[model samples]
Target chain A: MKMRVHSSCSAAFSARCSRQVAPRAASAQAPPAVQVDDFDFQKYVMATAEKVNVALDAAVPMAYPETVHESIRYSLLAGGKRVRPMLCLASCDMLGGEESVAMPSACAMEMIHTMSLIHDDMPCMDNDSLRRGQPTNHVKYGDDIALLAGDALLAYSFEHIARETKATPEQIVRVIAEVGRAVGSIGLVGGQVVDIKSEGKKVPLETLEWIHVHKTAVLLEASVVTGAIVAGASDDDVERVRQYGRNIGLCFQVVDDILDVTQSSETLGKTAGKDLDSEKSTYPALLGLDESRKIAQRLNEEAKALLEPFDAEKRAPLVGLADYIYSRTN
Target chain B: MKMRVHSSCSAAFSARCSRQVAPRAASAQAPPAVQVDDFDFQKYVMATAEKVNVALDAAVPMAYPETVHESIRYSLLAGGKRVRPMLCLASCDMLGGEESVAMPSACAMEMIHTMSLIHDDMPCMDNDSLRRGQPTNHVKYGDDIALLAGDALLAYSFEHIARETKATPEQIVRVIAEVGRAVGSIGLVGGQVVDIKSEGKKVPLETLEWIHVHKTAVLLEASVVTGAIVAGASDDDVERVRQYGRNIGLCFQVVDDILDVTQSSETLGKTAGKDLDSEKSTYPALLGLDESRKIAQRLNEEAKALLEPFDAEKRAPLVGLADYIYSRTN
Candidate 1:
């Protein structure tokens, strides 16, 4: 396995670098041999994420009126894990494609995700003061500017995919459709509405599950599937990647819910027990701690299973990613 | 013209349908027919608007985790003029293109526009209590939903362009870029930021122009250019169409300014003099009513001149549209 370990997080991800799936048990198991680690995949994914940020920034304020450019820039550059876009680039690499072809779509996915976050933090909605350890746009720039910024980012994401990259016409079209489906009623936005509506009400478990799957999972699916499509993967391959993304996304959320309960605000960069504070439905809230933990473990395994057909080396980063997701305490 | 008239208002339009461009001055000197008055364009644009609305209503509430999606949908479906999409569809007609190719782009444009409006009405922004004669989304659903609704619409707009339309991928891509440019900081969002920043301060005339052109005119330009592009018009033809749209857009704003001063709330269906009440810089404020009126007239004439090369029949609707734009008191 090739490695591009940044010193700051080295200790934390050393075992992860080997690309071997971590043992599900809490007790320390010896790390798997490093032979299967695919360093190129991780590097490619990160590099593409950076490139996407740059492209997104360049494409925005310049394309809009200067008055609102700074606000748009605020959220566009707001740092995050860049997970969704990384999924796009990594999946592309895993399927025998270069990042260049998939870069636009990768950037687009991030733009869409970032836009959602910006809007989600507005005074009218979440009214959140902070995100990813920074003041929300509405807090920094005021609500109007924040709103326009999010709007610009969303609109610009599609333009970036359509105009910035040279993907095949069919690919571009498919990407657009995929993006729409993820963001539309059956996907991200739809999920958001139901989630909001369920607030203060005791939501059915099925309803809660549907919300998570649509709002959070759909875009995750889009991120991975888009990469596969850009790489010209077969439909079956795309579906497999989507399944992997879905499991990982859910695992990621479940961990987030757990961390909200267990971690300090200082580490999480958000209020601890936010879900509890808000009385929002969460896995642990619905299933209890032990049951939720089991669910996360099962999901991690399911995600791993989806990647089984790919070369062991090609699948390393993804498998490692599943472990890393489940491992996050904050 | 092959026209489908669905409503009583639209039925009148078919009766008066003529492919020939009305003599330009004839409309200016006499009462010009407003297409919004014409039942076909009115009904067609309206139906398209409704379609967009349905999609918006269905999609915006999908945001996951509950509270978010509810917040997004509450405001997005509130009534609007649906002008952006209508302009897009009208532009397609001017280019002799089928509506099928232009429908998605038209809907996307409206979504972008609606996103802007929703954000503008937030409690932290204009903080308006009413929109389209109804309680603003924030006023009804709370600020959170309004914020999310705007975000969902913006993201969905691009997705719609990419996924729903039958236009070629290149066309979809181009439309996305065109619309994105209109929404970005350099465009509507940028103008808005400047507008907010410049509030209570004297801004340069150039800066003010920059704000309006990017914020308002760019989308208008995009509306027409996208229509032409999807319709497969020649570049020169598209440029010509854009010139026409540009003139009309400016003229429309000028008229709006006039209406803001002269029209009553009952006639306008929204707050009248809201611009003056806010002390916002407007054409009437900047240039005074008489001069603004003249400017609108000149703009209307210039807009007509751009359509001179179009076959006389194809130019009729636009010429009438220009006259109606300038002549309207509200």
Candidate 2:
């Protein structure tokens, strides 16, 4: 009975196109292809991300174990979209709170995200040699230092959230636990493990969906959830945003898989088609590229729908983000 | 002037011989060594560590991304003495408090320590093949998973403290900052950085002292200081005990150097002679064997002196710990 409920709600969204289930018209409200140029939300997001990036660079010191500290610095300074943290800051803003109130959480999420990237790009895991248009952390600093730098960043993230943020201790405590849950065995780490194990194997579709949800989606959801918590958003409000984040996170990854096949490494700043090369199961691999794109369009609509109760002025960026996730080619 | 004061203090303590520094005189005047043994203290520490270990084990589950989850569990459950956490637990007992109050702090310290160990044993840092008589985490889990595991553990440490401890929010905030300093550039990571940079070089004694004190002693001192904080001990008292811990931590490392030269891997549970082979400026390398022993002895005396204000019953184990450190051949 529990399994059916679990399969119906959270897992069903990802499993919509499976042969066992037919897609309904209600679930098929394909989001309009909003041109990226029309929304200027990208500019806001990019500007917000740039501020967080600069803040992160200023925050992490250059002084560390010489061999490993350089590696940590290299990875942190390596550029990315900083989407998760920017989303958090935006979420707080949407909840009628100051961005400063969410800055620490923003920085922490970025650090945690960067740490994951360092580990994910190592020779032993994804074994990629590049990130953000440059050599990956292990490639630049060697494996050992890369590993330690990641650990240092992770440690610093918690400390930063707890100390630098203005939230009360009780609130900090809640965010801290959520951060842990986002990355622990049940969060990002849990998802990566399954991804690795399923590589080159014909695994069940549900298992693959689990991997992406726990690994990629949980942290994304956590970003909004943490921001909402800090901004004093109601629990129901937080849950709605969480659901919004979940659909968008998966939609984001589905777009990524589509891009892996469609885009170039130069365009993506990371290995393109590498997932396919590794024989990893992806949305495109399961449902074909056209079907994956359709699923992503559907999920984006669902995500935007979840935000209907939110004030329209506040939710513009979120709705815009759903469009952005599906529209990005790289 | 500050440098001179630091140098004089270090030289004064570093110059003394071990035999002259042993607490034989103090123990003889107070209580017999045999009478001072507290079996219950050991049992209490063990019990507390066990409870934390159980909580940690249950905390990390093999869920989605089973491999990464398992990888995190592999490193976390890998056995060690749980000494850092024990220090927090023991300090609480010394201040007449229940282990429950200190348990979260204890667990947090252990997690930070474990994260360091995980990184330290990586191929880039210490490059150690073994830890706690087992293959290093990276060796068992691969560098990527090992890196991620350390990150998850480090971040989760603060999470555990913030969520689980009964201390005030202000106190939890303070503790998080303290732990960050101990783990960051000013503390363990900084020391490690210097140590790595100084490898095979003729570094000044002062710089070497900074490396050990920051890298190793800071966290060790933090364990004791945090325990006192958890018990609401006065700042002055905490400072005094911190000095005590600092002295002992340095002595402990000096003793460790001596053992590395004198003991076999079979007895020490780690490969010995790495310092000698690596040309790391250990105590034995800097002071010669006879002088290093004397230095250890003197440091031991200074450590015990700080505990004079505490009751003999409360301080016996701490003092005993000093003796046990030097007594160990391995």
Candidate 3:
């Protein structure tokens, strides 16, 4: 309640102008494990992701309304890197909260992320048929079921957080506000509508960044920021973490763009070169591959620098994540 | 917090079997304006709807993301009966809470209701073109914007409730939980999926009831129940309101089925006889018109009976609303 909820809602967009940071680029090398030698980031990711997967499974079971649940579970559990949830938990951990405190919000982030994917893959939207080495949600469940699955997942994301999160009423309400704003029109859906409209058009560089920032970066920002709020981070701390999230979020997509061109479909696990094949503008398409790589490096570095004032031990996970995103193969 | 959250989620369906209330019928003569002689229920509805419209407009402004916001406002503000918001406010009023206490949530109910309509009208769903006498949301906004508009409206409903409600955090959180569950799988979305699957051919009476209960009745139940919660209604009180809501919710839809056959599209202000046109099962189609009328009357009577324990004057709106649903023409 102490924080400005509306400001947080749009800070992701406004902060972009203030920071004047190059949006993102793409490339990967070995993770800079030296950020925290003893942290064992890889093992932490596996353990945390395991917990997230288990909770997500319980969140939406194969209940009597079987078909929709089946579709929701299919894509939700369809094995991805789970970068968003990990960032949420790690952000919460950095602020000295018990993992359990932010676990529900962390799970909620994945649900929202999963819902977006399910909807985006519909025939009326992106029309992609393959996701995560399997058929897209619409292909498997038909468009209507897939659509309802996404809607249900989106609703449940907020429900799960509101019902399960162990936080103050103020914090819980703020978290819901943040999560809701993150995915609403000005956030994910807004970016998506533009992306749909921009397809096959030679969109300008700013428009492309606007689309990526809103579509891809906003939820990632919400994931980390909501986790921080659940953990009782100060307003200053929350704002700082917001910038970190924004950078990594954009970087994650830029890396996906780079990998789309550089890697094969087999390595990406979904369709590769999808952006290029569809004539969609990406970081590499707009900024060139080498410049995109430099921008990605700068974003990853900026993301890490924002974490400098926090406890080295506590912030190690976040630091490690930026490196991981910058270095991951897929 | 004392009331069971999940129970409210499915209480609309379970209470149906326990009560063995015939799953709604169809007819309306006129609203029983005598429920409270001085109440002037028509004025109450119009006045409450105007307040809700203004609040909804402010809740989502025509911001920078012009297209998506326009799509959201297009269907949202395009005008409808505003039954959900009025029910919410009336319930809150009956429970001795200020109208302002539930106004935001009331608007949210409309927003969620609007989102459903937008999504349902898409080619991937029911594929309608006219709503409230204007082109459907997707027809004007395109399929992508309409889809995203629905998604944004749904998300903002929770955010609006969380940020705008003046209730205690626990109360606000409970409201969020109730609204979320109402629209989630066990609620609205659960019903929608079954409905899509049940389309064409002949679905059993039980299957049809399940769809109506979930798709139509669940959110109405949530509307009144959430208002009761925001007003600090006790668990027993909440359950009482839940039953009343469930009956009236089903009753509302049954009346629509009847009206579909009896009223002209001009009177109904949209496509008439859509149910029969699509071979969709309906109360009148299965139970005969007279039987449907009798059932509608019985449901209205039963809904009123559930409010007998409360003060008559305070509960006047509820009684008036039940009568109004049964007696409505268009």
Candidate 4:
């Protein structure tokens, strides 16, 4: 793929944050669309991530029973891509909503994501010692505190959205329900259970699809859909956003699986090749690396097509996000 | 105290389900009120518990990902007093709302309570093997699945209430917020953190009160208040229910401490005197047994008084519940 370094920002930063566009030969028959070369995807991701980080920090304070709050703050404040919250904000903005209105729900999405990471890294679960290049929650704080902190964060996610969201009661209720369903049995937890059971077994491709769709895609879908809901998007628009979210959600995981085998641990900030070591099935394992890369490209194209119905400028962040997911090396 | 066993039910059942009343001489200055001689407190408790158990059984099915669902059902369907759900139903009924309207929230309450118990009994936490006369969640399911099950249940609690509740959107939002707060860091998780930290140490009375108030009373308070909110009760009525719940909630824990010291393991359906064994501070430890009993009596009276404004028939279950909390030997 041909990559162009936009000169809108400083040359040094532009070199570090190049936006990669698919080669024109790959989409010869596609409609002429607004060029994404001018969009500063790096600046958009960083700015949204910084806003979410500040909001998260303010949401969970260093309160009494310092250990529990500290444990929560420790993992929550650890840096990440903030892809989910950025998607949320972008979707809301696309639907003509102000950033302030969707900020709580955005923060809530990150809180839930952070909580899953904390619990997933527990001694009884994945048992990882390092996450985001720091000691895992259970490794630093004892398992007991880490467990409570995860529970606290899960509970706080709903409370924060409900209490902090400035949307109408109807909108707030829908957001809560959406976020709740994404985190509940039929979503994250169910996927984790199936994944654990399928370990070391020859799992079918259908089952693998179900696992990733539920565990990862559901929350991403919620993030995008909730942003639209909070902004009072019409039913058609909501459905379009949901489709966009699902395609990219799957694309993100496919790329993640490829990176697990192809990238180094330092670049990933986690244990690379851990999936192969554990014999956990991944897209790259089931399909060849080349095939997985092809699937990701297809998904990115489909996700970007779903955003075509929206105004070009409004959809830039989401469209660029799809490409970002596909082009990420880590 | 004087005891009265209502003969409204069969003699055999009456013998097994006696209702104890405070001696008339104990409250000489109190106004003459509805006679407790006719109210079937045992029948009310049994009937509510049975109904709640059946509802709970129907709420969580043994579906795919059988381990997770079964784990939730195992602890949820296990026979217990179902005091929390009953409090919710009675509170809603008192405000003239149908049981159907409150059933989902009641089930959600049980789910949250069961989740707390499951996580609390994990190996990294309290690490108990027995709960409700059977092996605890971690003992039957592995620690990893148990942890996920707890998370699933907690997530489902909010979802169930939001999706199944028939109340107004405003009321549903309030209930979700209320339940979330009760389960978050400032409530159950917070109390557990402090209790764990203070283990084997001489905690002050104030610290103990804070622990019990946050740990036990908050959920009970949510139970009553949410019920009132769902029924669209006046703000005054909700406040009254909150106060009544708080008083009885403290009474329940105080009596529990007394029973831990006095009852056998078989009678309590779990390990007896475990708190004393762990050197954890309790009401009976901080205050003498006699003094704790006195305090419990005072709390029961205060709780009952809070219910006096409601119609006698409407408040029967709550008043009976307060007395039941006091008189249970187990």
DockQ for candidate 2, C-alpha atoms: 0.46
lDDT for residue B119 in candidate 4, whole number 0-100: 97
When summed lDDT is taken over every stretch of 10 residues in candidate 4 chain A, the lowest stretch is A1-10
lDDT for model 1: 0.70
Candidate 1, residue A63: CA error in Å? Answer: 8.0
lDDT of 2 by residue, A170-274 (tens): 777788778877887667876887787788997787887888887788888889888988998888988988998888888888888888998899978888889
Error of 4 at A30 (Å): 7.7
What candidate 1 gets wrong by more than 4 Å, as runs, is A1-67, B1-82
- In model 2, which regions exceed 4 Å deviation? A1-39, A64-70, B1-21, B24-79
Q: What's candidate 4's DockQ score? A: 0.77
Residue A257 CA error for candidate 3 (Å)?
1.8
DockQ scores for all the models shown? 0.50, 0.46, 0.70, 0.77
Error of 2 at B29 (Å): 15
The lDDT values for all models are 0.70, 0.73, 0.81, 0.83
- Candidate number achieving the greatest TM-score relative to the actual structure: 4
Candidate 4 per-residue lDDT, tens place, B1-330, comes to: 222223343342222224443432335645322344466766777778889888888878788778789888888888777878999999999999989899888988889899999999999998899998899999999999999999999988888887888999889888988999999998889999998998998899989988888889888888999889999999999999999988888887888899899889997888899899999999999998999988887887788777766776677777777777666766
Error of 3 at A42 (Å): 2.1
Worst 10 residues of 1 chain B by lDDT: B4-13
Deviation (Å) of A31 in candidate 1:
17
Model 1 — TM-score against the truth? 0.85
